[model samples]
Each structure stands twice: as structure tokens, then as C-alpha cells.
Target: MSKKEKSTSVNKKTLGRILKYIKRYSFLVVLSLICAAISVVLTLYAPIITGHMVDKIVGKGAVDFGALKTLAIRFVIVVAVTAVCQWIMNILNNKVTYHVVNDVRTSAYKKLEQLPLSYVDSHTHGDIVSRVIADVDQFSDGLLMGFTQLFTGVMTIVGTLCFMLSINAVITVAVVVITPVSLFVAAFIAKKTYHMFRKQAEIKGEMTSLVNEMVENQKVVTAFSMEENVNGSFNEVNKRLNKAGLDATFFSSITNPCTRFVNSLVYTGVGIIGAVMAIKGRISVGQLTSFLSYANQYTKPFNEISGVVTELQNALASAARVFELIDEEPEIAEPADAYVIEKADGQVDLSHVDFSYNKDVELIKNLNLKVEPGKRVAIVGPTGCGKSTVINLLMRFYDVDAGAISVDDHDIRQVTRESLRDNYGMVLQETWLKTGTIKENIAYGRPDATDEEIIEAAKQSHAHSFIKRLPEGYDTMISEDGGGLSQGQKQLLCITRVMLDLPPMLILDEATSSIDTRTEIRIQRAFAKMMKGRTSFVVAHRLSTIKESDIILVMKDGHIIEQGNHESLLAQKGFYYTLYNSQFAH
Candidate 1:
């Protein structure tokens, strides 16, 4: 199909999707349409009544004052009724528009939740957020404009044309002749600008992503004194967005003036034709006057609708982006009869597991491991090795490309992800805390935990001393980034969270890397207590932290180079030996 045809198809699909959300409020939409029709009919009647009142005045002395008075009263009532209907239409439109936006935003958010980790990992957080928030806002504005103006505009045009035909068909013909010019202008510009607007939306997303990245990493930029470099990168993105916006706006903006100019020509032709008919006695002067009013009304909607079309194009572009996110392929669905492991014995086995983020780049190949219940297994590897990947696979964040990972002798893929994750308590080197109180953050894993349990967990993680130092103690509010909290303090809160729920299986990936040595020792003691009688996987860079593990797996280039107890691995004097000695090399 041609490009134009493809665009038309996509736009129709987008509109169809939008209608599905609007259908939920069909009753309100119907009421709004009725109001629009009523308002347009009353508004159209005003011109006809005015013409009749004008006809009552035939050269002052022969004026029919009584008839004029009756017409005047009717005109007043029509205007008043029209105003009331228009008011009602606007109210209903706002309700439908905002509610539809809310539903779309909610669905987009829920879709994000169901999406695979790889999809999210591949996209910027800000771009995803933009689709959910900013794009939805744009769609709402466009929809509101379409509801308030587009419907009434179309109705007014039809109403006026009917009125004009009843008065004089010759003048109506003249008006119709120039109407297509306005529509053609509007359509041509709209078609040319839709792609530009889509480009603008994409660039705007990129700009949002850049801004979010800068805000989240401001400290890193400042510490590295890379502000100039970061600013340069931002400027580059800003330039592209600027050009996209300007190009989109420039094309869409011309639609209104061009259509309005054509509409003006249409009105001029009606006035000239109507006047000639009145002079020739084919129609009364008052009838000619009414025809002129109808002509103006007929052409007015074209101008208003052209503007609405421009806005609708923009809205459709944003809606498409949001829909794109909603339509993304979600994570692999679980089996129909997936097992829900409420209480796992925590025997995890990876047999011949092979995986890679990129298919061309091989990573984990034929990996195999087995962890008995209640055993503490430390996976020590260099930065790029598969330590964290193993944790991700265990939690089913990403499935293996080959082979199977089983928990308690059951294939992990065969079990429900929620239940599998419920069995494991994880703490990574990178900590994440939502905007809430310390007590709330601790109770995240178990929201029903008593305050006493939360407090005890905090104390065990050694975050209680710091909590007491704050003004509100455990109730002190913090931002999502753990504002006003040091890295160590944030890590303590994370540890406190795991300590609160104490799942049957634990995955600690450099969990103590952020805390200081003094605090680290205290948190380690807490972890040791938490790890007791629970299967644990510790991915650590600090060899001293994992020295006490029942078994240590040394990984290099995605393959296990060594696996044995600390003393046994040391006695081998291989990769594990070199890594262990390097930590205490000084």
C-alpha cells in the first residue's frame, strides 16, 4: 500500500482504540452529541428569525412593529437556549475526555507491569513515563477540542446549508462551490503534518529521557566534572527536538489560516450572489440577509474544524505512542497449570542453561549448578561475569535461552513467577526505595507486618540508630531516591526490608558493597542470622564477605572456573586463589 494509505489505516486503528475507551462513557458521549445538535439548531434559527424581523421593517412608516416584537422575543429565547446547550455540551465533553484519559493512562501503566524486563531494560525510563503521562495529557486535550468544536462545527455547517437552501438555492450553490477549497487545504496540510507530529512526539520522548537521566545522575556528572560534556549531549538532543517541533508546528499551523482564507472567499461569493438575487426581486432583501448569515455560518465551521483537525493530528500521534507501549509483547505467560509454591525448600538447580542479552553475543553457556536447602552458596566473579545474571535467572526476571532452572526439583518456568519470587529475598548493590517512611519501606515485603516487627527488623539491620537520630525517627518521610540518606543508610534500609520478611531463599548481590566497613560488619552479622536455615546465593566482590560460605563458585567468562569450600579452593591455588589474595594484597 502507498504511504498515505498506510497512514490512513494506522490513524483509523488509533481512532478505533480511542473509541474503545470512550465507549465506556457512551451515555455521557450521547448526551454531549444531543446537546451539540440542539445548540447548532438553535444557533441556526437565530439567523432566520433575524431575517424575518428585518422584513417587518419596510421603510420605517410601513414597519410591522408588532411582528418585529414577536420575532425579537423568539430570537432572544433561541440565543439563550443555544447558550445553555453549548454550556451542557462542554461539561459533558470535559467529563468524557478526562475519564478516557484516566482509563488510557491506567491501562498503559498496567501494561508496563506485565511487560518483560528486557523490554523495559531496552527502553529509557523517561520515555516510558512520557508515554504514560505527557502523551496521555496531549491526547486528552485533542479529544476535548474534538468533542467541543468538531461535532458542533460539522452540525452547524449542515444546518446552515439547509437554511441557505430553503432561502435561495442559487446562493447556496455559490456557497458550495468554494467549500471544497477549504476542505482540500485542510486535508492536504493535515496529511503532510501527521508524520511530522509523530516525529515531534518521538523527539520529545528522547528529550524527556535525557532530562530524566541528567536529573538522576546529576551527582555523578558533578563528581566527574562532566557537566560540560553532559550539557553538550543534552544540547544535541534539544536541537533535534527543536527542529522537529518547529517543523511540525509550522505545517499544522498553516492549516487554519489557509482554510479560513478559502472560507472567506466562499462567504464573499454568497454575499455577492445573494445581493444580486435580492435586487432582481427573485428573493426579498430580508431573505438575502438571512442567506448571507447562513453563508457565514456554513463557512465558519470549516475554519474551526481545520484548527481542530490540526490538534487531532497531534493527539493521534501521541495516542499512537502510548498504544505502542500498551501493545508491546509481555513476558512469556506461565503454563495453564503452573504450580504456586507457597513454601519452597529452596533447592535451586541450573542444568545446561545458556543465555545472552544479545543473541549474537554469547554469555552464559551450558551453566550448571545445584544448591541444597539451607546451604549458603557464594558466587564470586569479576564485574562482567554472570554473577548477577544467575540471580536474575533464579528470580525468573529473564528466562534462559536453553536448558532449565528448577527450584525444589521443579522447573522454575513451570511455577508461577509471583510465587517463585515470593520464596526469594533479594538485595542488590543498587538499592531502590520508594517515597515513604522508613517503617513503610521496611514493611514493603510484608505490608501486614506489625510495627514491632518492622522496628525489630530495622534494629537488626543496624538502621535503627540512624533512625533515632532523625527528627521523626521511623516516620520520617523520604523521597524515592532516598533523599537525605547516605548510600550506607539506603543499603541499611534495603537490608532492613529483607530482614523484615526473611524469605526462605536469599540472593545478595554485592548487598553490602555500599556500606562502610564498620556498618558492613554489623549488617553482615544480621545477614548471617537471616541466612541461617535458608538457602542463599551471595554474589560478592569482597572475598572476605563470602569466606564463611559453605561453598564458593568462582566464575570467569560465564563459566565456573572453580567450585569448592574456601580452604579447598585456596588449596587449589587457581583463579579463586588469585582473587582472594588480591583483596588483601596490600
Candidate 2:
């Protein structure tokens, strides 16, 4: 009904979800709770033993040394057992906390694989990474604190209450009456801090995204003299983060001291009430001393629990973020009887297709195309003309809004995505290589390729020379995205992957855009060899590269205005002619 009510509902839901994950390892959790209870019971017994030893001393040298010696031994044994049980509880807590964190982190990462491309396209990579790594790590800390402290704190409070009631009911009632003060303070602070902590987590993600973007493109930022501008943007984000973090911390920190203050009040009241009882001769000095010790033990948990509450709030905020990612709608499920293209015929047809990333903005409408087997079809279009969208559609990365796309006369949607993609070898302008040796990258598509085969493919793509020049040659370790290599070199490595195993169809979307003219010429020769007798779709901006294609489709504003071979299009002296001459114009 209200904002606070809604937040409380969300926190309850998030905490419920976390408990479900913890339930998967319920055995360890139960064991940990048992250890905490035992430890608390042992800890509570020590105060009674202390009070007994004190009462045993009637006067100087009139002491019952034997009884005192027995009490001392019992106290020592209680302390040692409490320590051992506490240690065991802590170990079990760590085990459960880290195991649950690992499971959640693994699930988040696996979710990325099933998520639709649109989801990733809409969100920054850094933010997604933050949810998986940084947010999960924060959740781990909170869960660990909750496990180690919350259970023991509750057990201690209950154990001390029972022990104190056994000694003196009047003083126990006084201590119990003041207990709600600490709980009320803890609850009030927790409610106040929940939203602030959530806001802080969001800002932290934004800060992480900005830093990742800057670090990844630091060279570009410096080359364009954007250091000052980037710094200004970063400072803006940093300032907001600082304010949110300080506000969240300031509120959560209040819980500890406020609860401690209430605890002191409870202890003082217990002492005063017990002293009155002792003077009235209703209880011995020993019993009063024991009641005072129980009062401290009972109130100590409130202080520890208040701190746990602070951490639990922070943890719930981060857990909500991680669950948000996990809850995203994944890609459209495949048909139960999805066809598998064992060997594709390479005949792709798009009929009456209509699609757009945003519904209001019409990018591709009533688009129709047909490519026969072994045809070299090139799509040449200006920027923002839906050149790449076609590639994405063909690969089924994005489904069509209207009409259908078919491979070999079978609807693309009818076939399994893995099988459809397996039939085509793709090389895009934007290259991607994981952290590994150059040899490993080249053989990514065909990991079982032998050394000789890898070298042959590398030589065909003209990457062999660079590979040999590296300090470790083919075995040289490269960072993620091929960090140690140039852009051209990275593209070459990608091309080499396709060369290593040429499929039935190929999609070369500006495959050679990064290579130098000299290297481009050599790579084109390799592509020409690779494209022989294979259905190929080439998307390019450099018009000269596609002139030799069997059919050139010139697109403008998502419409194919002209379609024919380069020679026929030029002879028409139409839009394609204007585009062709402009590229070769003096």
C-alpha cells in the first residue's frame, strides 16, 4: 500500500529466496545451529559456576578449598567446551555461506548464456558482471555474518533467559520488560537502512560500469583527448556513490550503538532489582551475582543481533539485484521436435519479414530476399540501413516479428539454433578472442585440430607470420579479447578459425575491415578460396570488396532499391550506379 510496505515485501521475498538456496545445504545449516546452541548453553553455565565459587568463600582461610577446587575445574571445563563448540559453529557457518554463494554465482553466470541478445544489448556488460561477482561477494559477507552471529545471538538470549528465571523470577521479569527496547531500536534502524543500502548497491554498479568502460577503452579516451571529460563524468558518479554509501553506512552503524545503549539500561535495571531482592533476604548473594551475570549475557545478544541486522539488510539488497538478473526472460524456447540440419543446403530465404528493435521505429518491413545454394550474395548498405539485422535474423539471434525465414525451405524457427548456426561460418568486423594461446584461439571452432592443420589454417589466413613472431609463437598466451594483439591480428585469428573448418555457408560481415590494404588483398584471396561452391552472404561498406559477388543488393533506409550483379547495376545508372561511382570517383 505504501513505499515502505512495498520495500518490506520485496525484502521478505528476497530473503525467502536466499533461504531456499541455503536449504539446498540444509544438513550443514542444522549442524551449525546445533553447535551454536551447545556453545550458548555452555557459555551460560559458566556464570552459575562462577557465582557458586564466590559463595563458597565464607571468609579468609575459612574457605572450603576442596569445593572451590571442584568449582574451578568445572568452570575451566565449561570455558574449554564453549570455545570448541564456537569454533565448530564458525567452521560450519563458513562452509554453508561460501557454498551457497558459489551456487548463486554459478547460476547467475549460466543465466547469461540463456538470456536473449536484446537483454545484453540493453544492459552494460560491466553492470551484469557486477551483479555476478561483486554483488555475490557482498551477499556472501552478509550471509556469513548472519550465520555465525545471528544463530548464536538468539540462542544466547534464550538460554540466559531460562537460566535467570531459574534463579530469581522478579529480576528476570525486570530484564525481560526492557528487552523490547533493543529490538525496537534494531528494527527501526533496519527499516531505515534497507532502501539506502539498495540505492548504494545500484550506485556501486554504476561506478563499476564506468570504471570498466574507461579501463577497456583508455587508449581511445586518451587518443581523443577525452581524459578531462571522462574524469568529469567519473567524478559525478563518484560523488553520488560517496553520498549514497555514507548515508547507508551512517544509518546501519546506528543500530549497534543504539542497541548497546538499551542493553546497558537493561543490565542496570537487573542489578538494581536483584540488589533489592538480595537485601530482602529472599535470595543469597551468590544467586544475585548469578542473576547479574545472566542479565549481561541476555543483553549481549541484542547488541550482536543488532549488528547482524545491519549486515542482513545490506545482503538482502545485493541478493535482490542478483535475483533480478536470474529472473530475466530467457530466449524463446525451441520447439519440442526441433529439426536438426545434419548438412545444410545453404538456401536461405526471407519472405515478408518485418522486425524492429523498438516497435515504434520501423527498421525492416516487408523485407524479402532469396539466396540459392552456392550463391555469393553481398548486401551493401549505408549505416543504419539494417545491414547487420539481416545477419542477426538469419542466425536466429533475433526472431522476425512478421513472416518467416527458412533455410533449405525449412522454417528457421523449426530447426534447433545450435544446428542452424553450426551450418554457417561467420566472421564479423568486431573480433572476439578469449584468454589463451594463439594456437588455441585459432582452433577454437575445431579444438581437435592437429598442430599441422592449425598451422595450415593460420598460413591461409596470413596470421602464421605474426604467430611465429610472437615470443612463444603459437603457444604465446594472450589476454582476454586478444589484448596483446593488434586489431588486424585479432581479425586474422578469427578468419583463421573459419578457415580451419569451412562450413556449408559463410557470413562475412566486414570481415576484413580491420586489415591493412595489403593484408586485405591477401585475406580476400583466402576468402575467395574459402567461399568457393558455398552459399555466402557478405555485408560490407567498402564497395570495392563486393563488386565480384554474384548478386549485389544495394539497400537504402532498410529497402533494397536495386539488386543485380555489379556490372548490371552500373549499367542501370540508378542508385547502385551512383553508389559504385562514388567509391571509385577521383
Candidate 3:
């Protein structure tokens, strides 16, 4: 990680969110603080009693066995009580920390659901996972340690100061004089390292993204014999992470030792000053001994705090990344009065529609088309000729920059998105099958589908035969994105999903591209039966597939240059004719 890699600084808003989570467990937090105070006070008793025993031995001629026995019992009781309170505080701290992390993690996941597809398209899956998992854990760990230290540290510092003041005010003042030097050292180092820690967290996310990409695409990498290339890319990212990690660790590591060195100076000064006061008869030897103990206890907390500050900076950076994700802008909001489409007749019209992923580069410009209910429309175009863009617009995955798309005279933007989308069944070239049983994957489009319906749909789409051969049949588990299944098999499963849905409108974008020619012919027959009395749009590479369509659109450079049935386009000897001729030119 370098300055070139974007880093998110911890702002006041992110800090306020952490505080809000803490306030949710306010009662428990208060209980924790109370316990810490009692523990710290009890801890001070041992040193105080030790000072008394010293006085009993030195100030008197003979040793007092009864007094020593009483001091020993008091010490034991103080240690036991302190241990119990600490145990309780640990329990309370863990409860508060994990609950806060759970809330943050859930919010991040929920935010992903609310976000548009564009956001997911724009981010790496592994980075998103790291934000929700690793980042939140780091934030939780820091908050837990910070809270635990803060309460007891403050109590210990204050208690030690009071005890020392009571013993000898002059020695106490000398100890206080050297305190700011140690604090300054910690503060100075912390300020310079905030950016370094932020970079480290960012690089960690990137490294995770690289690792996930390599793992997920390993088959592709191996097929291309690009394992060495993939390793090279990973090594680049890993090396950056190493450099960033080293820098972050170096800065944070120095903080503790440097603060401790400052603390040692303070300790040495207090020890020397207290001994001088004891010899001058201004303070007793026993008083000097207790003051030294109090001084050591006070300085130790300050040292621990310097380390906590560094840990917190790193955690804050991780938290800011999580908050940034949660704060992402969602898709355009639907109106409260938007129309709802319970069912669609599949009458779709795109009038003067314009859209572009990039404003300067026009992808879809002034596109106009209309189709009647229960009609078939086929779109034939070269790659990047706005074929997928049209599908995206129809699905409202990316809303048009201008004009409107309407289904049955109901403008899509004017209706609730869920109701509008529920009207259409879609199967794309890229199939997505989550980890689940085959039955569950088929039922994804229509969760309430009966077992009989699922099996029937699978058979209709030619997926049932292959599924029956698998172990456990319909109960066979599918890996992420249907890992074990071939491309053709995955396509069959997707087609089965669409078949089960039985929507009034269907969009098949290269739906049969992955299937073998024979299988494609078979599925096309199934599709023809399924397409009857349904408004269907087919985007196919095979000219044979669209020969009998109601309409064939030949598109180029984001515009439909020719529109007619297959025979008419070939008769004209135009762009579609040349495209059709080239496929079977041999």
C-alpha cells in the first residue's frame, strides 16, 4: 500500500457510530466500569499494606507477628476480590464487543442487499467480504480492549495519585512533572502512524480480493495454463501488503518501547526524589516505599494506554471502511404512489430510450421498439452492440438515462420494482446457482413451487435426466455457481428455473449458447412450446434459432439497422444476410 492506494480516514461521524453502539449496552458498560473501579481500589490495598509492614519492621524495635498475620489475610482478601471483579468485567466486555460487531456486520450485509447491481459490479467480492467480516472483527477487538483498559486505567491512575499525595506531596509533584514527556512521545508517534495503519487495512482488503479471485477462477487459470501468471499477479499484491504491513507494524511497535523509555526516566526521577525526602526526615521510609509503588502503578497504565492508542487507530481505519460501504447510495427510490403490477400481459415498449454506462461513450441511443402481448422478438447483434444493455434496461437493473419503458401501458419506473420484475422470467448466458440442493436452485425463481412442478419443469427443460444420474438425484448439493456442473448442465438448471416460473414475459439472452447443438435443438423445442401465448425476447447467436420468430432485429453500434423476419432480412441481402451467410459460409 502506498499513497496511490486510496485510504479512508476515521472521521467524527464514524466515531459517533461506535459510541452509538456502546450506548446500546450502556447498563452493562456502567456495570463494567463499577467493577473496574472496585478492582483497581482493591489492587492498591496490597501495596498500601506492604508499606505498613515495612513501617512495623523498621520503625519498631521487635517484629510484630500478629500485625504481619493480619496484613497477610488482608492481602489475600484484596487479591481474591480483585480477581473476581476482573472476571466479571471480562464477561461484560466480551458481551458488549461481540454484540456491537454483530450489529455492524448485519448492517453491512443488509446494505449489500439494498445496493444496486452497479455497486457490486464496481467492487471485488473478496473486498466486500473482508469489510463485513475481517474489518468488523478488528474494530470489535479494538473497542473491547480500549474499553477494558480505559476504565481500570483511569481508576488505577487516580487511585495511585491519591495514595501518593497522602504519602508525600513533594514526591508526588515530581512524578507528575515527568508524566507529560511520556504522553508527548506516545501522541507524536500515534499522529504520524494513522495514515500508515489505514493503508495497511486497505491493502489487506485488496490482498483478500486477489486471493478470492484466484481461488474462484482457478479452473479457468488452469485451462489457459496461466497458473504462473495468476501467481505473479498475487505476488504483486502480496508484496504490497508486506510492505504496508511492515510499515504499520514498525510504527506501532516503536510506540510501546519509546513510551516505556520515557516512563523509565519518570520512574528513576521519582525513586531518587523519594529517597532524598525519606532521608531528610520530611517523610517516613514506609511512606517513601508506598509512594514508589503508587508511582509505578500510575506509569504502567499510561504505558498501556500508548499501546491502546495505536491499536485503536488501526481499528478505526477498518471501521471507517465498513461505514463507507454501509453509507453507499442505493438505487433511485420508488415513489409511494407507484403503480403495482401483479401480472403483466408482456406488452413492452421502449420509446426514445437512451442509456450509457459512461456518459461520454454512448451505448444505447434513441432506441425505440414496441411489441404486442404474446409475441416473440429476437435480437441479433454483434458483441457489445447493446444486446445485454437492452436486457438490463428492460429489467430496470440500470434505469434508462432518458425516455421510458412500459409494460401494458404501465411505465416501469412508475411501478413498484418488485411487482414489475416478478412479471418476467429471465435466463442469461451466465448462470448463477447458489450452494444448495438441485431442487432448491430450480425453485429459486418461484420458491413456492411444488416438488412435482420442479421435477416436471426439470424434465421439460431436459435437465431431469442428468440430475437423476447424480447421487441423491434432486437432493444432490450444488456448489457455488454450480461448480461441479458443466456449462451446459448449469444452463439446463437455469432453463428449468424459468420453466417453473411460467411468467407471462420471458427474456432469453444467449440462453442456449452453452448447450451442444443437439441439446440446443431439444431445448429450443421445449422453448417453442413454452413460448406459445407468451411475450418472449430471444437474443441468440444461432441464426437457425430465430428463423421462425415473429420479428428479427439486426443491431449494430447500439442501433437497430434492420428489422424484419429471417427470410425478409436474407432476401434484402443486407447486414443480417451477410451475418447469416458468414456462419454457414463453408
As a TM-score, model 3 comes out at: 0.95
Residue range 367-436, candidate 3, lDDT tens digits:
9999999999999989999998899999999999999999999889998989877988999999889999
Q: How close to the true structure is residue 270 of candidate 3, measured as C-alpha lDDT?
A: 85
Range of the 10 consecutive residues with the lowest summed lDDT in candidate 3:
2-11
Candidate 3 pairs with clashing backbones: none
Candidates 1 and 3, the one with greater TM-score: 1
TM-scores for the candidates: 0.98, 0.98, 0.95
lDDT for model 3, please. Answer: 0.88
Give the clashing residue pairs of candidate 1, or none.
Answer: none
Clash tally, candidates in order: 0, 0, 0
- Ranking of candidates on lDDT, top first: 2, 1, 3
Better by lDDT, candidate 3 or 2: 2
For candidate 2, the clash count comes to: 0
Q: What is the C-alpha RMSD of each candidate to the true structure, in Å?
A: 1.1, 1.1, 2.4
